[model samples]
Target chain A: MSVELVDVAGLDLEAEADRVSARIDDFFTSLLQPPGDSRDQLYAAMRHAAIGGGKRLRPLLTLAAARLFGIDEDQALRIAAAIEAIHVYSLIHDDLPSMDDDDLRRGKPTVHKAFSEATAVLAGDSLHALAFEILAHEATHRDPHVRSELVLELSRASGPNGMAGGQMMDLAAEGQPLDLDAVTRLQQLKTGALIEYAVEAPCIVTRLARDARTPYRGYARNIGLAFQITDDLIDFAGDEAAAGKRTGKDAGKGKATFVSLVGPDRARQQARVLVEQAIDHLSDHGEEADMLRAIARFAIERDR
Target chain B: MSVELVDVAGLDLEAEADRVSARIDDFFTSLLQPPGDSRDQLYAAMRHAAIGGGKRLRPLLTLAAARLFGIDEDQALRIAAAIEAIHVYSLIHDDLPSMDDDDLRRGKPTVHKAFSEATAVLAGDSLHALAFEILAHEATHRDPHVRSELVLELSRASGPNGMAGGQMMDLAAEGQPLDLDAVTRLQQLKTGALIEYAVEAPCIVTRLARDARTPYRGYARNIGLAFQITDDLIDFAGDEAAAGKRTGKDAGKGKATFVSLVGPDRARQQARVLVEQAIDHLSDHGEEADMLRAIARFAIERDR
Candidate 1:
């Protein structure tokens, strides 16, 4: 079969993904290029960090969660953009030489490696501040309560006890033996925290049913963990070219990872179980949950 | 005057300053070591950057502003702490090799130079975020609208079009012939913005008269400009030991500064005018404004 024909079965997924990606691009474009400004280099750094990359998975989760509650796509877009900004900021900082020291990201040069470290730092800082600014500026979030909650939730997720805390834990755990529980907690904080925020943020604003939120949170938590585990497994087994990053680099650096702790087979098994749990959480939602489950499964099984 | 009288007067100032300093110190210590499992190294870096030696001018402005409105000193402490965090984050990022590239700040090693650049960036990021976090957490602000407004004001002052925009302008103007107007605009955004925030935040939270905010903003604007011009003059003529920084560095770098553009004598004259204007704004408020006016004069006239 032709390549197009082989991919045609997942057309709905592809179309939704494309729509989300375009929204993200528009968001970044609007954010980085404010009208009538001539700080070209700073904007360039911001654009370089934000545009033209990533799976848009964080934003997709945000949009998906909003949809489950009947939120219009437009309402979701602003927040979707904001979460992506936070996620992009994290990745930019993570790739700094003082941190992960990676030169490449998403098949391209990392922001720090591409721009100067100073620009990278500023760009990351600007992106982070911009995320809050974006949420605050959203005309749709007229309720002060909604705006405040969004700011609080995003800040909690992105700040010390969330992404930064997880990163610190990961840094502290380098070359150390981390059991399954420890690994899970670290992943939950570092990656899952933002994911949880992404899924829960729309619900927080819309005041969705607690019953609906509970399952979405459960599904997000499992998928978030599964996403990291599968990522670890991919780093162990996937081709560097296909992955757009150096495979086995994790082991080379003596970084404590799931694959290092439990072997690839068990890591894969864990991811499978998490994906199953994630899907099970959605059984009550009918067809609306199909994209979420599919995305979770894809997160676990994707080669890269 | 007799030596005994001199000692008594100086001691009063010293004791009051010490009391204020202790408040600043306690603020840092509490934030750095929050109760329970909340402490993290990023928080430590933030505390380190913020708590280190400085004149505590911004926090003092906050305290003074609150006191002028008859607000309790204790009630003002959190706002004082939050503004200081914003100030410190600006300084930390400013001292980065990419920005000001200063090795020393307030007689101590700068954050990025003292710690890893990555840590410095993260520390600045965390502190900036923490400022809003603390503001939002201020339960004493019974009105949610007040809390939201406080957050918005601080965010705007700290983000682009305020301090960040000023830094960009400063960077771009290096080695260029920036006119006096351009220099004032830069200083207003860079320094005046936060000073304005410091003075206005308390009033905003207390729901003080809308007219009350105008004078404070005027006072802060003039004082902020005076502060920068005095700083420029100090850089031109002050000694390194007393100034706590490398003397004459601004002119040496060919950066377009107030002193460099208008000459040191003119800069000093302009600073005097600004201080007078700053004091004039507080004419409506009585003795409480005296200390604030005294501070503006001290800011301009200090040799260091």
Candidate 2:
């Protein structure tokens, strides 16, 4: 039984996703290589890694969260772009031979596999630095303190204690018997932290009214965890063609995924519970929360 | 003949280097993982790549410049540490299989060779991000505009048109004939950019009186270029043991170098001229410029 948001029209969802995607595309285009630069190869590698595929879920969450707080979309776009940059950088490095060693990501050859490993590594490093640079540049992000906070949040989420740390845990536990709790903790840091940062950065930047910030944090945390759970579920049941990735690879690797620990049926239930908790926090905002609610449910139920 | 600055006593140079080194050690220590964190492996890789060996040349120049302008050493320490972090990150990524493919650095196994490639990549990426994060957090850099400038300068130095671009050029030009102009441009982007940033940042951060900032920029550019040329000379003449790297590797790789484009004797002559030009920029300043003068000469004249 897949859950879907009944009130929001399907066309609106597509439009919102497209809108977020366009904004992100434009952001990368603008900040990524100015004219007359001789470093075309490096810029090409960066663009190759950033553009072409993957749902702009993190940036969309950032925009939606800001919209719920009544912040202007223009004001939120840089922060959104910064989140996606960091996310893309992680994916690039994660695909390297020394890491997950995956040949394909989002239906394309992974960065290191497609380009040379040196370019891929440098591309990831440059993109990671670019995220903060884009955020810190006054022309892009005007408020110094807000820019500072954005850098801090992105760094914390991307660094060892966050996504990188989660990756290390995932690497160490590849063939180990991790319990459900260990799996959850790993996912929370690996995937959840960045998602949480995406949802909360705009609020932190805008200095949302204190009362509004508190509940939104709760809303973000739940959805972030829910997103990871659904991601794992998809990996478990997803078709290789539709998913654009090799399915069931996790089990072959002896990875301790949520489904591996608790079984798929229970994992699905936990995901739904998380979606419910995520939506509950936005009850006070009514229609303003509708898109977000739809997104949370959609994230779990989508085939790819 | 090797140029020397008689004004800067050896004791003073050692004292400043020691102070900067200690501060860097403290910064790395504070960044150590909390017990039970999943990032212990990644953190260890980063520490291993960063701690001990190598001349802290970039950071020393930063400290020396700040000192010349009467900025307190305490105020410059964070920025100095930040520069070293950037330099270390570049080295780790450069030595990876996809880039330089070197097996060793500073007489020890390269980070990727010592640890897993994934850890090396992540550690490099983390250190790059950490440099910006540390700079953004500088309490001393309270002016938003100045802080923004610092971020931009460092980013430009670290990004495509800077170190990354240089590495790409090196890759593209390997075993190919590169003219003197192309080689100089590449070195400027690769090595000179960071050295330039190292010198300019402290002055920018301190909001040095306009007159001082102008001369500092000129001095930095000359010293930066001179430093790279000197590096080529050392690679041509220095011993493997003294350089902490295999001597004559560049010649073996058929890589273009200043010494390759110009004869070794001519390269040495050019380096001396640049160093003299670098020192001349500080003529208006008194004894404070002595250390920088000594450093410029040392960069070119050192055996290693």
Candidate 3:
């Protein structure tokens, strides 16, 4: 519940990339303090998934977006924490035996592997609840409209029409023949929705009208695809240690992906093009958007 | 989503229990119209779990409470649907192979039996997200503060410190020597929290302060315990055909429940006492509280 009152104006995104994980970890560490007794293990699983590792890309995107608009640091960070919580929840659920069946994530045992499957499911469910809890808090924004809107947008982005919908498509399409458009739509929901929310959330906080949000949303959509392409590329051809998960999963499951459909070389080229397009969408902004631009590049550049 | 506006005030609780299912079914039917293609199965599973049966006790509680305050019928039903969505979601997840492993719910095939386990999980998660989405909607209430608080309360009720936490304790307590107090605490979270929210949501919509909610909270707590005790009694002695879900799972699992701790006669007597206490807490109100009083009695008297 403690908010670190950092000077968002003074923080440099490029410089803070290394520190972002620690900051987010600290945020989650304080945010997820167990209420003790029999439920302590639930909190422990949540902490293991939430506080320990990962690049914190989604939250960093939220912070970078908030910085672009000079939004209140506390508001931005709480929103960031909410976004990151959703991302982490999705990862935990995705790693479930009924889903991706992964044994590892962030180079450690997945939630289901480390905890009982029932505990992992409950942990993920609890974190999903916590995301809304954060967004609905008065501290997230003084304006009730902003808080409500944050809850609305976050829920929509993560719900059936968004991330959950995308995951459903992904599950249904497994081992089945799928075209490029199908995969694109699937990824757009599973990964794209949350990423778009990460960027657009600050806009919601600022109450920027939807008509005026084209550039920001375009940037989000493009980077989202770019990020997914890079992910597929890594899975298709990257070191297991570097990626910190079971790579070649798409191929192992005989599912078509960006890499499989377009081929690795063309997929990489598409990702580069998408990242460039993402940057282009932000051309209307000045140096304030530099962090967002760097993140777009990082979408393709990150080995994991 | 289409909102079916019922004149909650004119509706009689004792007479309406039979009608509540059809009304809630219509609401969920319209609410969960799945966009076509691969994701349709997810929605189908959601509809399968949400639409068909069950007593609709929780949402009925919300509607009854809303009647007390003359809140908008649409707003009331929307909130009711949100509460019901959370309830149905919990049931779906609870029946998963990893959890209670039940094959039947509402006298029909469980979600996982009707669909793949992955789809069931996603469907449950989607319903969970949909609950917040409904609460955060502008139509739920004109006041954003009301909406935000509802989100906060419901999330808190359903989150780690509430329903999920309770479920965790329930899982851990299986085959363990759980005392009466521990069983009470576990049930308080697993089932009581959401029920408490059901009675309090209208208070939130009306912006009733916490200090003013003592009687209401007391009423909720008592009825919640009464309802659970009745449920345990049913599980201990009632027919599975009448209960919808499998009976005797509590003793079958060797977990201590209200009936396990207290003799069935004492459990029944205690439930009746709690119901009286619940009705007594609402003594400050007049005829408007009659429905709630009816519900309290029904809590102890219903066979199911």
| DockQ of all candidate complexes | 0.39, 0.54, 0.80
Residue B227 CA displacement from its true place in model 2, Å: 1.6
| Candidate 3 per-residue lDDT over residues B1-304, each given as its tens digit | 0122123422466577666667788889998897889999999999999997888999878888887899987788889999999999999999999999999997899999999899889999999999999999998888999999999999999999899999999998888859889988898899999999999999998889998877888899999999999888877776444556555777768789888787889999999899888989988888778778778877886776
Q: Check candidate 2 and list the clashing pairs.
A: A118-B98
| Cand. 2 TM to true fold | 0.92
lDDT of predicted model 2: 0.78
Expressed as tens digits, the lDDT of each residue in B30-117 for candidate 2 is 7655436566788888888777757898888998888776877765777887788899999998888878888989899998888888
Q: Write the residue-wise lDDT of candidate 1 on B1-304 in tens digits.
A: 3566445544544465567778988878876774233235566667668774788888777877887878778757787787888788888888887778889888888877776676777777677767667776645365556666777777778766677777776777767757788888878877889999888987886787788689889889988988888877777776444546554676666677888778877888888998888878888887666557666766776666
lDDT of 2 by residue, A193-219 (tens): 898888888788777765767777777
**Model 3: lDDT to the true structure:** 0.87
Candidate 3 chain A lDDT trough over 10 residues, lowest sum: A1-10
Candidate 1: fnat, from 0 to 1?
0.25
Clashing pairs in 3: none
Arrange candidates, best TM-score first.
3, 2, 1
By TM-score, the better pick of 1 and 2 is 2
What interface RMSD does every candidate have? 2.4, 1.9, 0.5
Q: Whole-model Cα lDDT per candidate?
A: 0.76, 0.78, 0.87
* Stretches of model 1 off by over 4 angstroms after superposition: A1-10, A34-38, A138-140, A208-213, A239-247, B1-17, B34-40, B72-75, B138-140, B208-212, B239-247
